[model samples]
Structure formats: structure tokens, C-alpha cells
Target: MDVEKVFCMNGGLGENSYTQNSYLQKKGSDMVKHITLKSLEEAYVSTTPESLGIADLGCSSGQNTLSTIREMVEAIDKTTYKFSNITPPEYRVYLNDLPTNDFNAVFKILPDFYKELNTERHLWSQKLKSSIYIAGYPGTFYGRLFPDKCLHFIYSSYSLHWLSRIPPGLYDKEGHSINKGSFYISKSSSLQVSKAYLDQFQEDFSLFLQSRSKELQSGGRMVLILLGRRDRTHVDRGNSFLWELLSRSFATLVSKGEVEQEKVDEYDAHFYAPSKNELEHEVKKEGSFEMERFEMFEIEHYSGPYMSHGTAVARTIRAIQESMISQHFGEEILDNLFENYGNLIDEEMGIEEIKPTSFISVLKKL
Candidate 1:
């Protein structure tokens, strides 16, 4: 599959859009706001660049996209005044995501974003001397995306888990799928399936670090918040089980002849939730950045204000995975598939508590 073509969150501002369903991602960002701000401040103080370069990788469309950028700007603004006692540097912000991302939505909202920034500046009795220029950069982050030594602060949230492409070796020489009946690593998957995923992540993440190392200035800082696991185990009750529920939803569709079994067996999600050890190992081995801070937190699937936990989780997953699912399984099954998924989540929630885990890391470019 061409991941660049079909891999994108559900776009636009509709009920099922990522804009409406990204509260959980917002919450995780909030959890690490302090760390992100501190890291950015430190990077700015160290460099004192006349024109500050900041890039938000995997910055998808919506309020969350600009909201996070706004906060980072605010942090730099205050830090410049507090430490350097001078006007902030000229801001050059790059908002990046896949080419298929709904950049139109983001572009349309720029006026309001600028207005809000100006209003906040006035409310704080601050005289701005430097202008903030924002631009959209459409591309993948797994490779080079910027000029050498141009960025001082980089941020990516809830996006690193997505592999550059589906890992190879899921099928044999005869093209028979090995990870049948599951879209991700599961208890039933063979060891080869698990190793393939880990290898892909290692390659992608190392390339990510290498690319960013070239783009980042010395003493630059990058804050990464991604879905993660608590231990070395490839299969867990958190994200892995969520995929299990999704697989069961497909099974229900197949059983009713709504979708073909062959289609289901041949599909696999291009995502991996790595452990803390896995992240540390890669960072050390790559030798380009120093790990400043690392944290792990859990977001309960049932914490949303929706009428039911299942509805909330279902909406969130749909906003993220609908594009891929529709491209593969046909858009006709989305409603029934999510309905079945929500029901399964409700049943599972009644019996056991499930909370998805996330990680926040602060890396300083050496």
C-alpha cells in the first residue's frame, strides 16, 4: 500500500473529524505542556537566534494543531523577556504533516489564529517587535524535511507510532498472509511478525533522529509525545487489545458477508506502540540527541464525556483509522464496523478496565 496516499486522519470539522475527536490527544499534550515549554525555553536561551525556527512535525489539521503551536510561541515569548530581557526573535514556524492531510482547514483558520495571538499579546501589555510567520510543510518526517541546522525547537505529538510503511514479511513466499485474523501484533502472531514490527520502528525512528539532527541547530530541543507501551512485551491489553476489538469488528462483518474474509486477513495496521526501553535504546544508539526527560502516562478510555465509553473510544479510533479502513475495506462498512466496535468496547469495559498508555520525551540535539 502507498502509505503516503491513504494514511491520514479523518479530515474537516464534521462530527467524525479529527478536529472533534482529538480531545484525548489534547489531554496528553496538556500533560506534558510544562516539559515542552521548559525544553523550548532552554533551547531558545542557549541559541538566542535572531530568527527562531520551530517545526511541528505530524501537525495534523484542526484547533489542536494551531493550539499547540500557539502555546509554544507563548512559551518562547515569555522566556525571551524573562531571561534575555529583550523582544522575542522573529518567529518562523513550520507546520508539517502528510500531503493528504487537510491543510485547507488549517489555512482557513490562520486569520483567527493570528487574531487570537494578537489579542493575547495586547492583553499581556507586551509590545511585539518581531513578527511570527507560519507556513505549512507537506511531507513525511521519516526523512529530511528541512534545511541543515535551521530548526531550534521541534515538536511532534501522538504521531511517531505510525510506521513509514507496512512492515514487510507479513506474507510468505506464496503470498499467504502470516498475521491472519489480526491487523497488529497479537498473542496469536508468530515471533517473526513481532520482530518485523520492531525492526521497522528501529529503522524509521533512527532515520527520524538522523534527519532531525541535520535540521536542528546545536543545542536545539525536541519534545515528542507518542503512544507507547509500559514494558517490552509486544502485545498488551492497552493498544493491542484495541486492535483486537477492531479485528473482531471485521470478523463480525465477514461473518455477515458484508466484507470478504480475504480482505480482512490481508490487512495490517502500520502502527507500533514501543516501550520506554525501546525508545531509550534507539536514542542511545543513534548518538545525535541527549535524552533530557522521559515520562509515561495512561489515558483511560472511559474518561470522555460521551454517553458511553465505547462511543468515545470508537470515535477517536475512527477519526484516526477511517481513511486507511475505507481505502482497504470499502467505505460502506464504516458505520456498521464502528457500531460493532463500540458494542465490543462497551462489553469489554464492563468486565475490565483499560487505559491506553502514552510517552513524553525531551531530546536535546548534541
Candidate 2:
């Protein structure tokens, strides 16, 4: 698949758009918001740069992207107050995603976001602050996007689990698709299938660091929150069991001749969750950044203040994956497929079930 062409969050504020369905991602970011604020705090205090340049890698179109920048800017204000009791520095924020991302949707909402941000700053600062410039950088994060030392702080959440591309060896010796029967690594997948994913992640992540190293100033901080496996055994280990049920739903469609079994077998998600060791190994291998903090935490399949209804989880996943899936499978069956997925997933959520966890890594450019 040409991920650069088809990969993107569902755009606009519609029901299926990521803007409306990204509660779990927002929750995870909220969980670590303080940590992110602290890193932003340190980015200013540690360097005292003339201007603050912040980048959100894989920053899809939504409030989630702007909200994160709002928090970072607020932190810069707070940290500046504590340090010098003076005006905040000039601000430059970069929102980056793939070339195919819905940048127009993001741009449409910028006026509102900027107004809200300045309103908050004016109330506290007692005077107008300098313009908080926002720019949309359309490109893949797999390579360098900015000049050397261009960014002082960076943040990415609910991304990074997406490999740059599908793994190389899904087709076995028979070349008929060794991983044909599964969407991702399952109990039945051969060892080769598992290693192919691990190797791809290691290569992609290492290159990710190398590219970022060129853009980040010395002492710049980065916080990356991504899906990851708790088990030290393999790369494709944790998915909140969301995929298993989705795959099961496909089997139901296959039984009714609504979908082809071979099509299901031929598809594997462009996703992988690495173990902590794997993450550490790649970072160290890349030789650009040093880990300051590494942690793993769990998030519910569906999370919010109110009791989440049955469809929230399914809607969220569908918003993110439906575009890619429709490109491979026909678009006609998505409604039925996710309906079945939601039913089974809702039925299967246990009160005490161990949900898939996210790996939070805080790094500093060396």
C-alpha cells in the first residue's frame, strides 16, 4: 500500500472523523499532560532560546493537535514567568503529518484556536504577547523536514506504532502470503512473520531518530506516546485485542460471501507495538538522543468522564483505520464489518481486563 497516499485521519468534525472520535488518544495525552508540560518547561529553562520552535510529529487534523500546542505554549508562559517574570518569547509551532493528511481541516480551525490561545494569554500576562505563529508542514516524519536545530521541543501521541510501510516478508516460501490468515501477529503466525515486523520497526524507528536529530537543537526535548507491548517477547504483542475482534468480524463476513477469505488473509495492519527493550535498542542504536524517562501505562479500549457507550471504541478505531481498510477491501462492507466488531468488542470488555498499554518515552537531543 502507498501509505503516503491513503493514510490519514478521517477529516472534519463528522461522526467518523478523528476530531470527534479521538477520546482515548486525548485521554492518554491528558494522562501525561503534566509530563509534557514539564518537558516544555524544561525546554525553555534549559536553553532560554530567543524563540521557541515546537513541532508535533504526525500531528493529524483535529483539536488534539492544536490542544497539545496550546498546552505547550501555556507552559512556556508559565516557565518564563517563573524564570524572569518577563514577557514570553516569540513562538513558532509546526504541525506535521503525511502529505495526504487533511491539512485544510486543520487550517480552517486555526483562527479559532489562535483567538482562544491569545485570550488566555492576555488575561494572565496583562498585555498582548507576540504572535503565536502556526504553520502546517505537510510531509512524512520518517525523514528530515526542517533545518538543523530548527525545533526546540517536539511531541507525538498515538502515532509511531504505524510502521513507515508494510513489512517485507509477509509472503512465505510458497509466496502466497505467509501471513494471509491474520491481520497482525497472532498465536498462529510463524516466527518469520513476527521477526519481519520487528526488523521493520527497528529500521524505521532508527531512521526516525536520525532524521529528527538533524532538526532538533541540542538539549531539545521530545515526548512520544505510542502503543506498545508489555511482554518482552515480540513486536506485535499489544493491540488492546481490538484487532482480534475486528478480524473475527471479517471472518463472519467471509462466511456470508460478503468478503473474501483470501483478501482477509492477504491483509496485515500497517501497525506494530514494540517492547521497551526494542525501543531502547533502536534509540541507542540511532545515537542521536538519550532517554530521560521511559514508562508503560494502560488505557481502556474506550475511555471518558461519562460511562462510555458500546460504540465509542469501534467508532474511534474505524475513524482511523477505515480509509486504509476501504482501499484494500471494498467500501460497501465497512458498516456491517464495524457493527459486528463493536458488538463483539463490547461484549468482551471485562471489568478487570488488562487493556493494551502505551509506551511513553521522554528523550533529549544529545
Question: Candidate 2 on 96-163: residue-level lDDT in tens?
Answer: 99987888988998999988889999999764477799999988888889998989998999889998
The residue pairs that clash in candidate 2, if any, are 180-265
Per-residue lDDT tens digits for candidate 1, residues 303-347, read 646558898789989999999999998899999999999899999
C-alpha RMSD (angstroms) for model 1: 1.2
Candidate 2 residue runs with Cα over 4 Å from true position: 173-175, 234-240, 301-310, 350-354
What TM-score goes with each of the models?
Answer: 0.97, 0.95
- Output the TM-score of candidate 1: 0.97
| Whole-model Cα lDDT of every candidate shown, in order | 0.91, 0.84
